[model samples]
Target chain A: EPEVTQTPSHQVTQMGQEVILRCVPISNHLYFYWYRQILGQKVEFLVSFYNNEISEKSEIFDDQFSVERPDGSNFTLKIRSTKLEDSAMYFCASSEARGAGEKLFFGSGTQLSVL
Target chain B: AQTVTQSQPEMSVQEAETVTLSCTYDTSESNYYLFWYKQPPSRQMILVIRQEAYKQQNATENRFSVNFQKAAKSFSLKISDSQLGDTAMYFCAFMVNYQLIWGAGTKLIIKP
Candidate 1:
């Protein structure tokens, strides 16, 4: 079975620096999402993308954050200025459709460490 | 706002035994979706099972099953014949109006 893939499984960056976490969602998926989980905490939704536009975003997804498909197969989340609070496991997920019962397939996650 | 709650923070069960994890949610929407995701040490969120609000019958997959009570806003997962591989952090999530609400998760340990 095909799975979502994320690159640079672990990222270390200084505060106030820019960082882009990349994801290659399932080849046939139509909806993409980004979620963050602080160590030992609940996973919080960041943003959702579809049809080349942001379908929805949580309050945590502020002006400093942005997402782009950039290409047919890649979805990237960019944080303009990283903060210590930004350290977390970022997961990228995709679904064939946004149906009520459809389950999103998730990547292994990129552990971002903001120093 | 929709909120999912998993009251149990951690639990342990012997292999070959059964374990049930509880979950509850607060939602105003009549139609929505519920899911159980298991994340092992790898931290990859794997879909274990799903339940739709309108469905009367519970969703089941192999040893994993759900007991969904929409009226009570409760959805629980029961794992039968639990194995070592079943040990993981289990999260209960709610989907409504295109938003996914996640619970804190219950850390389940399967002892040999």
Candidate 2:
């Protein structure tokens, strides 16, 4: 089975620094999403990207957060100014279709630690 | 606003035994989807099963099955003949308009 690949399995960054998380979704997948899970908390949706633009985003996604599908292959999430609260496991997922019941393929999340 | 609830925070069962994980959700939309995802120690999220709200028949995989009650708004997962590999954190999710609302998750431990 195809899988979504995320780079830098573990990232440690200083507070107020910029950090870019990269992901390579499956070759044929069309829809992409970003979700984060704080320790002991439920997963929270950040944003969804399709057709080179954001389809929907959660309140957790604010001005400091931005997503880009550069070169039609790598989908990147950039946090201009990281905060201590930004520490969490970020997962990248992709689906072949946008159907209501389609399955999503997720990467082995990138754990980000902001100090 | 939609929310999924997993009543059991953790459960344990002997290998080859059967285990059931409970999940309930709240939503106003009539048409939607429900999903079960398992995250192993590796932290990789894998799809276990899914059900479409419009479908009356329950969905089943090899050793995983769901008891879906539409009117009651409940979706529970049953794992029969459990194995050690089945140990993971299971999350129940509700989906509508391509957005998934997740639950706090239930941790299942399969002991040999």
Best by DockQ: 2
Give the C-alpha miss distance for residue B18 in model 2, angstroms: 0.5
* Predicted model with the maximum TM-score: 2
Write one digit per residue (lDDT tens) for candidate 2, span B1-112. Answer: 6899999999999999999999999999999999999999988899999999999999999999999999999999999999999999999998877888999999999999
Residue B57 of model 1 has an lDDT of 100
On the 0 to 100 scale, the lDDT of residue A33 in model 1 is 96
TM-score for each of the candidates: 0.97, 0.98
Error of 2 at B87 (Å): 0.7
lDDT of 2 at A55: 94
lDDT of each: 0.94, 0.95
Residue pairs clashing, model 2: none
lDDT of 2: 0.95
**For model 1, how does the per-residue alpha-carbon lDDT over B3-95 read when each residue is reduced to its tens digit?**
999999999999999999999999989899999999999878999999999999999999999999999999999999999999899999988
Q: Which regions of candidate 1 are displaced past 4 Å?
A: none
All candidates: interface RMSD? 1.1, 0.7
